[model samples]
Target: MSGSGSQGNGQRLRADCERCAGLCCVALPFTASADFAADKPAGQRCTHLTAENRCSIHAGLRASGFTGCAVFDCYGAGQRVTARPELTPGPEMFAVFRVTRPLHELLWLLTEAEATGHGGAARPLIAEIEALVDGDAAELRGVDVTAWRARVGPVLEEVSERVRRGLGGRDLRHADLVGARLRDGQLRGTTLRGALLIAADLRGADLHRADLLGADLRDADLRGADLADALFLTQPQLNAAHGDGTTTVPGALTRPVHWPSGSSPARHEAPHRARGMPPGKAAPVGGGSGLGGRSGNGRRTGRGGRGRRNDRAGGADGTEGPGRRPG
Candidate 1:
């Protein structure tokens, strides 16, 4: 079950579009591509958005050339900004979303750390970071993002390492591990941030506390993989990756909305099981609720990443990731 995020001052890190003001659709920019239908500038509303700040083409985002929207999650930043209407729109508004994003991500990881029985650095980092996050937006902007990352990143890394010693202390950042065969590998505490894991075989891998930030997991098999306390991993990552009910996820994350409701997906029930594709198959381009079928059966056709939107995260040293806020 997804956490209620009701602890005294805990935050809800998932996007709540109903209470938002289409901030994501306007605050962030997007370029036309397989992932996006058109180019929109920062602070400009997406053409597909409605007057009431709702997405007009939300259900058929992919068909309408806005597949990027389907994979994006604001982690509740949009609602927070909307609630504080006093904050003017523009750079400052955008900054509030951007600055809070990493902080909320940190909160998510801290919550997971606590859930997984971690009592060390996570608790201290959570307390310190939460206080900073709750401060004024201007104060948050004054914060040195890099310096703060330095303090929390290393601590989280160490805690994850001590807890799950599998491949501990390995700096696998920006590794080109695409299509590599490592089913059931011990990747605990490994820095897989920015790694190209497209079509990789990670079935049953032990990924406890792995830093999967900006990692591309399209069509990568995750059946039975233990992703407990994995850092910076979002729902889109899980949706793009292939996993069964047995795949262990962090406490703050719920199963992908598109996954099969069982421990494993059978060929008969899976719609994306095409021939000539890779071992693990990705789902439809913009369909994130189901596990993606990258090269499964007949879905290969050509050279495409596991999930279309996933390419953003793994793009350019794997730092792009989902854009700010949510519609």
Candidate 2:
């Protein structure tokens, strides 16, 4: 409805956050609720926001019942353009995100449509938006909505380099990576709200009680990942990842997925080498010695006692258990 297609000279494209100032926060309307306390109208200023356009109540948003504000992601608008490269001076940065706020909302809807399997209309629209962004990179520093729209297009085509940079990493929010190989990685209780995973390989990872709100599971591999008491991890995330008959996920989460067809669900066990060794040595070279051959341990302990050590370790030799840590 608010301009939705590509035009000539790329004038039909939408605004690009990377090339604009931060807008969504200052322009949008919000009602008082459990998440927000102030009742502000559209295009009005937020009480917590300062004259420099910074949120004065940023630190106390959550404590003051503004949880929703805490989780909102502006599709990398702030970091990509305004905060990045220290784009313009402080005063100029204020207007950047705000000017493009309305356009950002529109673009967000299109992106949602694209993600939900409606790419046909969204694709070209996004392309047009990209072109406009290129033209407005430096011009939008001042306020000229018509000129900006005239130069840009109604829709966006392709992604701006700035926006793309924002989504470079995985959006683990509401994701499920059970038994997934995230060893020694920095997944500190990530917000895996409601993801579906089956037998992932998460070994020796530092998942200090991640939030697993409502994930699905079938057969995941959470070998050594420490989700000790992660928040929100419900039964769904556990069950979808093969959390079974005796499997123990986070203390607060429940197992949703049934075990494999014929086999009984196994219990959550520590890494083999981790049995008697310290937590540091949990991920041994032949970590899951049972899955791969003992030869894999060559790098860890060397070929010192090869044969004798193999038998003494009571190696299963061919059974693929949960200890196989993916790189």
Candidate 3:
């Protein structure tokens, strides 16, 4: 679950589309698939993008085969990039956005870590990343994101270990368990970081305190699952999976609107306010879920790093692509 007192930083990690300039709609590519109705190349403005920098079809994105748009969280990168006058509506802006997106994601992780009571260890990294994020567009574009991840990934892993300290569950890091049947399993405190869990049957499973960083949950069944306090669980991961009203989530996340209304009694309703949302402001039409970081086959794609599709296709590092849709 989300720790108290991190609400301020959490607000910065969320995408505020009202403040953005349709960067995701213009900078990212989407192939015609079940997730998208048509092919769109990078750097081209989406046809559905309105003159006011909003999605014209925002209200009916999923119904119009643009489910991908509904779940693509920019981690607040879009508004950040748009705020810079030097990088406005050009290749440089998109390039900086590509880099800044992952940096913001790292910020999200660090903030969550601090919220979970690792502030002493997580604060420094958070400060360092914040400095990078606030740098000029040129500096952001030049950042070696791969090297940064290499340094930061271990710290996050350690944080996960600390959070999951006594529960004693399986260490399934990077394990390939796609399509596995694990309904009602006892998985509290399991380390499933980077696990491929696509289409896995996890109904009624206990995942409290389980580490799910970079786990591909697309098409996974989460009905009646206990995910309260699941470490590093993000809105994008929840958006990709199938859950119901009975599926318990962390206090930091809002329930995805796409989830089926269940007959089971609801557990914790966490705050209705979306993370990163401004106080007293309503959530966007689609609830403004996080970005999808998984690929079609359930692999975690890197964001804005070497071998990652910088300013092009695929997801930011450690998450699924922006083009992914509900399963």
- lDDT per residue for candidate 3 within 2-114, as digits (tens), equals 43324845667777777787777777666565456666666787787768776667667779876556655677777888888766787888787777877777677778777
Task: Give me candidate 1's TM-score against the actual structure.
Answer: 0.69
Compose the digit string of candidate 1's lDDT tens values, residues 1-327.
112222412446667777776777766655444455555666676676778877766656646654445655555667777676557667777767656655655565555555544535678778887688677879876766445555655555555455546545477765766677777898877777656575677878887667675566756778788876565566667755677788888655667654566777522212132112223222222212111111111121111223233332112110112332223
Q: Per-residue lDDT of 139-224 in model 2, one digit per residue for the tens?
A: 54444433332232222222211222333333464243433455456655354433433344554555553433323222355544
Instruction: Quote each prediction's TM-score.
Output: 0.69, 0.29, 0.80
lDDT of 2: 0.35
Best by TM-score: 3
Q: Which residue pairs clash within candidate 3?
A: 1-229, 11-276, 292-320, 293-319, 293-320, 294-320, 302-317, 303-316, 303-317
Better of 1 and 3 by lDDT: 3
